[model samples]
Structure formats: structure tokens, C-alpha cells
Target: MKVQNKIVVVTGGGSGLGRELVLALLSSGASVAAMDINAAGLEETVALAGMNRGNLATYALNITDRAAVEALPEQVIARFGAVDGIINNAGVIQPFVRLKDLDYAAIDRVMNVNLFGTLYMTKAFLPHLLARPEAHITNISSMGGFLPVPGQTIYGASKAAVKLLTEGLSSELLGTNVRVTVVLPGAMGTNIAVNSGVMDTLEVKGGEAPVKMLAPDKAARIIIDGIENNRFRVLVGADARLMDAVYRLNPQRAARFIYDQMKALLPQ
Candidate 1:
């Protein structure tokens, strides 16, 4: 669906790709409701939006709260008149450790933010989206969702659940006014580690070749283009595209490749 004049809600819009999406949507003439748990981050996003600030509204929300999530459509409608689309982009990563060393609390937190949060937002806004003449839902999964990463087992699992959930939603919503799209993005230059509270514990190995990271603005553009064209799956970055093909051709090899790359971060 075309974004012009549409009212779109984006989770985790305080920073990273989410913030970029908000700015991009506003520039495309869409009214946006940018939701995030960090109020300061939201402020920063708005400040960066410049003149497009008029087309944007910021909401400080914890998507894990079902009650709060369920109430979003009403609030968004009150602010922007109607809800046409929602992008579930808020997610956190697990600590850089093997699953055996990972704590249940950490696992639960990742599941709550990544899987359950996406589900809650989709369920809450789906009805409103269906009511619109043209509406869309975009869920952000990760390259790790399709290819296994040794140190991020729980994070990968949560994203994989999102991948399937989004696909199922797309199938179920067939012939409806609402369109569902899932995004698989590769490594991007974002503060996700900081936002997810994993930066301090995340270990990086030196002497490893640096991988080119996708910029948030570029990623946002690709995602918005996918939404406009109503694509079922959107892959951002060259790494994501390459991995998608690799996984398709050889799932085992893809898994092993990712494991090899990430195993260095795991505790010896």
C-alpha cells in the first residue's frame, strides 16, 4: 500500500532502524506514531526529524505490556485519526554466551520482547488495519532467525518464531484489506546492543575481518519500499540477501557458517 497520507505505527521508534522508519514515513507524507520504551530516545528521534516533526507523534510504551499494547490503536487513532499500518521492530538480544550458560530470566525477557511483543501488537492493531481500505503490517525478524548463531541461540529462536508468525499472519490475512510483510535484516550500524543491554557483556574478537553493516537510513528505505509494494518478505542489506540464498540452497551449511562466525564470542 502507498504510505502517503497513511497513519503508521512503529515500535522501538526511539532509535536505530525504527527511528529511521519514522523519519522515512514522514518524508513519504505518512503520519507516524513512533513508540518506544525510552522516552529520551523518542525525543532524540523527533529532534532529528526536523520539519517533518509535525507528521510524527511519539509514545513511550513497553510493548510487552499486553494491556498497553491493546490500548494503542485507540490512542493512535485519537492522535492520527486512523491506523493503517504497524511495524513490530522492537526487540532485544541475549548475552553473548552459549545457551547452557544463559539464564532463564534472560531467555524469558528476550521471548517477551521479541516474540510476544510482536504478537500483541499485531493482534491489537489487526482489526483496525482490516477496517482500512489499504493497510499493512511489517514484522522485523533477523538474519539470525533463518541462520543459527551460536552465541545468540535464544535471540535467534525468538526471531524465528516471528518469521513463522508473520508468514502465518500473511496467509491468514489473504484477500483481506490488511497486508502482512516480514523483514529479515542483516547486521546494521545500530545501537541494538546498547538498547538491549548486552553491549557491556558482548565480547568481540580482534583480527577478524570487518563485515560491512547496513545503514539505518538505507535499511529503512528498503523496508518502506517493500511495504509500499506489499511484498510478503523483505530482505535488507547484501548480507541478508546473500544469506537468504545460502540458507535456501543449503540450510545446514548456512547454520554452520553462522555458528563459525559467532562461536568466537562464546565463552571458551
Candidate 2:
């Protein structure tokens, strides 16, 4: 569905790809309700909006809270009169550790934000989306969702759940007005590591992190394009694209390749 003149809700809109997505959607003439847990980050996003700020509204809420997520539809609909699309972009990663070393608290936080949060938003807005003349849902999974990333095993598992959830929702909503698109994004040059608190635990808090990533604006554009075209699946970066093909060809080899690359990030 075309986003022009449409009301779209974007979760994780405080910063990173989510902020860029909000700005991009506004530029495309879509009215956006940007939701995030970071009020300061939301304010920063609004400041960055400039002329497009008029079309954007910011909400501070935790997507992991099901009650809060359920209440969000009404709040957004009241602001925009109706809703046409939802981008479940809010997610967090697990700490760099093996599952055996990972605590249940960390696992729950990752699963709650990455998996259940997406599920809650989808369920809350799906009925409303189906009632619309035309609508769309975009869920952000990750390259790790498809390929094993060693230290990020649980993070991958959560995103993998999102991958299947989106595909399954797409299957279930066939012939309906609601269209579902799943996004698998490779690393982007964002503060996700900082924001998710992983960087705090690591020694490399400086600018010496390995692996250059795609720009957030570029990723937002690709995702928006996928939503506009109602694509079944969208891969945001070359890394994700290459890895997808590699994983399909030989899952074990791809897993090993990724493990070789990411093992350095894990604690020794």
C-alpha cells in the first residue's frame, strides 16, 4: 500500500533505524505516530523532523508491555482518526555470551522486546488493519534470524521467531486488506549496541568496533520500499542479502563463516 497520506505507526521510533523510518515516512507524506521507550530520543527525533514534524507524533511507551501495546492502537487511531500500517521495529539484543552462560533475565528481556513485543503490536493492530481499505504490517527480523551468529544465539532465536510470525501472519491474512512484510536487516551504523546496553558490558566502548554497517537512512528507505510494494520479505543490507543466499545454499557453512566472524565479539 502506498504510504502517501496514510496513517502509519512505527515502533522503536526514538532512534536508530526507527527514527530514520519516521522521517522517511513523513517525507513520503505519511502521518506517523512514532512510539519508543526513550522520551529524550523521541524528542531528538522530533527535532530532526524539521518541516515534517507536523506530520509526526511521538509516544513514549514500552512495546514489551502487552497492556501498553494493546492500548496504543486506540491512542494512535484517536490521533490520526484511523490506522493503515504498523512497523514493528522495536527490538533488543542479548548480551554477547553463549546460551549456557546467558542468564534467564537477559533471555526474557530479549524475547520480550524482540519477539513478544512484535507479536503484541501485530495482534493489537491487525484487526484494525484488516478493517481498513488497504493496510500493511512490517516486522524487522535480523540476519542473525536466518544465520547462526554464535554469541548472539538467543538474539537470533527471538528474531527467528519474528521471521516465522510475520510469514505466518502473511499466510493467514491472504486475500485480506492487510499485507505483511518481514524485514531481515544486516548490521546498520546505529547505536543499538549502546542503546541495548551491550556496549556497556564490553571493553570496546570507543570507535574501534569491527564491521562497518549500512546507513540507517538507507535501511529505512529499503524497508519503506518493501512496505510500499507489499514484499513478502525484505533484506536491508548487502550482508543480509549475501548471507541469505549463502544460508539457503549451505546452512552449516554459513553458520561456520558467521561464527568465525563473530566469535571475537564474545567474551574469551
For every model shown, what is its TM-score relative to the native structure? 0.97, 0.97
Q: Which digits, one per residue and each the tens of the lDDT, describe model 2 over residues 61-118?
A: 9988899989989999888899999999998887888889999999999999999999
- Determine which window of 10 residues in candidate 2 has minimal summed lDDT: 201-210
> Which residue runs does candidate 1 get wrong by more than 4 Å?
207-210
Looking at model 1, residue 51 earns an lDDT score of 95
**Highest lDDT among the candidates is held by which one?**
1
Pairs of residues clashing in candidate 1: none
User: Compared with the true structure, what per-residue lDDT tens digits does model 1 show for residues 59-87?
Assistant: 99899999999998999999888999999
Cα lDDT of all candidates, in order? Answer: 0.93, 0.92
Cα miss at 148, model 1 (Å)? 0.5
